[model samples]
Target chain A: MRYGGDNRGRLLIIVLLVTSLFLITLDLRGVQVIDGLRTGTQTALTPVQKAGSWLVSPFRNFLSDVTHLGRTRNQMEKLTAENEKLRLTLQNRKTADAQLKQLKGVLNLAGTAGYEVVNAKVISQGSTTSFTQTITIDAGTSSGVRANMTVLSGYGLVGVVKYAYRDSALVQLASDPAFKIGARIAGTQQIGILSGQGTRKGVLQLLDNTTQVRKGDVLLARGSQNGRPFVPGVPIGEVTSVDNSPGAVTQTADVKFYTNFSTLGVVAVVVSGSSADPRDSLVPPKPRPTPLPTVTIYATPGAVEPTPTPTATK
Target chain B: MSLRRFFYSFPIFFTVFLLQEAVVTQMRLPAGGINLLLVVALIWAALSTPEIGALTGFGAGLMMDVSQTSPGPMGHWTLVLIIACYAIAFLGYGDDNIRGNPINIIFLVTIGVVAAQTVFLLLGMMLGQQVGSVSNIAFLLAGSAFWTAIISPLILKVISFFHANIFGMRSQL
Candidate 1:
């Protein structure tokens, strides 16, 4: 209830605010000192956080299960027989399919191209602030996981490992605005840079203006010299739409990713790709485009003109 | 600020921080996730003195920054939370009734969450992050604020019970 002028309290608040601003400035400026502090603190707390996660996950599961207990019980009893019958029916088919694919030289071979991978569990999704699109996996440096290692689900590329602690590591999702990959269009072999649009869809910027890419064309990572961060031929996504801006030097298109980041479960970390973090090749993020106020029409006879939609093309 | 107050409230902040990161964050809602820690900080700040409020907010924000998975400028949350806690404490300095009324706590939490999130978004944009369109950020802020408000009362009651039991004081509610 002390609302009166307290100079000491005011001074303390100012000091705290100033200190916070200083920390932010230092971090933004990429001060090596603060980076060390961040790394050290993160390393020290990883164990405690991991232990806390272990203790809390079961309780969380129990709470969720209880909430859906009635429906779950009803479905469980009904599905038990069906599950057994389906399991028996699919077992032989799965084995036969695997044998067939092995006999043929046409399998999505994960480690065929001199890259070693380790499977890791997606323990957590996103960050506490939720400002960045990232996830934490259970594997870390202890399990040969390191920074800049490519992470993927069964479908395709997910992201690259950003940081690795002793027992855990952080994976920056491919949908993060800052993420980019050098990719090539399947069949056409046209090179382009794929960047995240901070959503499910990514934007692929073609290197050549004249490059012809169509919808449903699968994009693959054009892995670097050693394939460190991104290995060659990993499926990224399929092109959904191409931007046809008149007289544009570089063409852009919207890509729908094969990996579903929302429900990411078991992901593998490619431990032996690059000697160094290969993130430098990615193009720097451009500022979000300001929305257009109006549209212009170019009327022409005997030619159908597509409506020009304002978009950020870089 | 009394030493007892800081010691007593810090645990609640830490516990809330852990739960926010571990449990609450896992339930990713459509319009981004709700920040349960911000609500806890606001409520705790409202109940304590300005110094305690500011300190608690700083601790909570620091924990969040540490636990965050991505690499961005640190202390953004710390700065936002500290200022928000200070403002909340200033506004409720003489309002003893906030501690007793769960509805008031919910309302304060809703407003506080929105204010903190606005500062967070603006600062994030300033730091060269391509944080989507204004409408999208606004939608997320409002959704998260609403979700935080909905759960503020229950969370506050639990924290209050813990604080009371630990300190041998009567529960605020």
Candidate 2:
């Protein structure tokens, strides 16, 4: 009886130790385990998340209404002006309908493959202390919004879906410290990796200092290399200021996002598969260099084209 | 373990957690805001037996951790609260009858607030994250202590009344 009790205690200790070791290993690995755990948690908590969302929906709507009421008049005027301009542009474009359609078809074929946009309402926001800046949206599994879905607003790319439940999904915003987007300057075509600095404002790092870039330049998501995913030509933000650090090969700049997250009401979620060549389709083909004229001077008898005198000094 | 007692306690705990997450978190002083949870935990510890008080504190801390966005592992909070509760119970300053003693509640809550902040700082250090500078920590501790000292009397009175009237506990109040 004494031996059996001692053995049982030993077995219990061994089991506890092994379990702890496994957990520690899982924590150290980080990405794979966290991804799996988040997905599983999303799946398991789908019902609860949906219920919680529904419970908060009324409050969110009321708050949105009150906020929008303050700016309704200003927004209506802006919309009316925009409507007139768009109508005029549409009429002119229709006159060249065939040529425009052909161009659009060619551009669409070369650029984005089949993709569709879905709109989702922001439900809850992640707290300040949370590691990632994420927001829960109303669309989810039923809406075809899945993990890795790209989220955007009128301004540009907002984030990617980290996890999806039945009626809601968490989107890790582009402003999150861990987020990195491959981007390029719109005019200069200078490529760089845009990283979030965790400020209310964000910064993009240009890898090559030699690349000509300036403030007021627009940054666009130019896609990613390897199997990494990104949306092409999404307007990221405008460069507010540039910093050239001493002895560093790269220049960094602060980007002020056009999407005002503080007043974010409606946003569109783009449902698309990972593109192999996100940048390829978005970048306009380089303008063909103008052929240089070959200068040939023909010397006539009377012209006496300046005679080349070797050793004139002698 | 009575169903009635469980029902009453559940709402109190739930409300405390919700208030901590929402309102209290938003209340930022120049230094740091009040830790109402610590104040309540301390009052409970002072009014109960040492073992039970420690257990209650652990449960409260566990719930707080769950409702928080802390990067630390789970159960870290349980350990901190248990220690705070144990210290309060071992001091033996307040009595069961002293549950309604406003001055005594204020003194105990002040101590508990300091103790809780110290534990949080220690935990952050052990976890290899510098939450803030020493001056910032001291500012937070003093701020919370002052807030708790000012507010504990009214909270204690209400809590005592609930314990007596709703919980059917003997009128310590």
Candidate 3:
């Protein structure tokens, strides 16, 4: 509209753009000042974020319940008597029940592996701009959380701490494309490298082609030497599919992470690694296949066929 | 764009920023999550003149770049937003029909968000960052656009009213 020789606007944009590029270069060059700014911003804002989280979670849940009403309707009918009973625990505080379950799961996981962990509430999820999938936990150096420490939920590895401030830490979700961990197939020493693809899914490359990498095979973190980033025997994911190329040096598979990063409310940071690799002990029990009622079917010819249902892993 | 607006925006930006981190981040849809701060800022830009829009972008980008959850280097967002917001402002500025129509403004915002995201990804690739597969990028773009489209009208109204009151555009209100 005002295309009439806006010299000032042009000058402002040029100066800002140049400044932006310079800051980017400085950050890329691993400048300490940039890190300080980032740390300072987060540290300064953590308390405010925590307060907001407490105040806003209810409205968020209400909104989610409204938007997801249709999906929830479908699930409501499929709920088991046990889940129905659990749902009745607190009619007004159903979310608390779910969070309690998740909290227990995280604690049980840490307890099993003899990990010295700091349990933290996930105050935030991924960024608004979303350069990477991440979460901010309500734990930090004061709680013994450090950058590169393994962070896991009840289900499995959620991420590793990217930066720890005084009372909060930023976790880079395992689903980030940049996330990588050494992993092993459950019940075997077959090692591989797992990398994220920006979803719950990941890609794993086994070092050897001779060892079988089959569908449904459980994967676990193989532990770093000092266990700074990943600890041994934490369940990583299950192989969803595999690609076997004849001349390839390694085998690759599509892995679905055990932890659903989106719905995560609670997680734990392992301040210290386990004394020994727990191996496959942490592997979650696979859901047993439903058995066919052969006798009943034979007696009742017109009866419906057995329909397999996926049990809710929540 | 004025010192008065700057004084008013600091608290507004930080509040929206906190809400984004606390609540918006938790409601991640299957496609992608909404960037509340981005949408709000873009709407603010879309309703303003080029000069004001540039200033809005500068503030929003700083909040984006310095955010702890931000994975990109310090300036990627700043650079992308300044250009995108300025262009949006330039196109919609002084156009009564466009500014008066909520539909036009929302459409402008949806496009601006997508454009900014594309530029950000391209910049990321240029810097050797992993941006995921083409399909992933496409999904993210559509998600951002869809969410922004759904959310921008409300933001446009709020930002428009705020500007009218604070920037003294009583006639517009």
> Which candidate achieves the best TM-score against the true structure?
3
Candidates in order, interface RMSD in Å: 3.2, 9.3, 2.0
True lDDT of residue B128, candidate 2: 59
Give lDDT tens digits, candidate 3, residues B57-144: 8889888988887768999888888888888888877777777788888898999999998898889888888766566778888988
How far in Å is the alpha carbon of A257 misplaced in model 1? Answer: 0.9
DockQ of each: 0.39, 0.09, 0.59
Q: In candidate 1, which residue ranges exceed 4 Å CA deviation?
A: A1-4, A29-33, A44-77, A80-109, A112-114, A247-249, A274-314, B1-4, B26-31, B96-100, B133-139, B162-171
Each candidate structure's count of clashing pairs: 2, 0, 0
User: What would the per-residue lDDT of candidate 1 be over residues B59-158, giving only the tens digit for each residue?
Assistant: 7777766664634577888898898888787766677676567787778878988888778877787777766444556667778787887778677877
lDDT of 2 by residue, A202-232 (tens): 6778877777667888887876433225656
True contacts kept of 2: 0.03
CA lDDT, candidate 2, residue B64: 50
Model 3 Cα shift for residue B28 (angstroms): 3.8
Docking class of 3: medium
| Residue A246 lDDT, candidate 3, scale 0-100 | 92
TM-score of each: 0.77, 0.55, 0.87
- Candidate 2 wrongly placed segments (more than 4 Å): A1-114, A225-229, A273-314, B1-173
Q: Evaluate residue A213 in candidate 3 and report its C-alpha lDDT on the 0 to 100 scale.
A: 87
> How should the candidates be ordered by lDDT, best one leading?
3, 1, 2
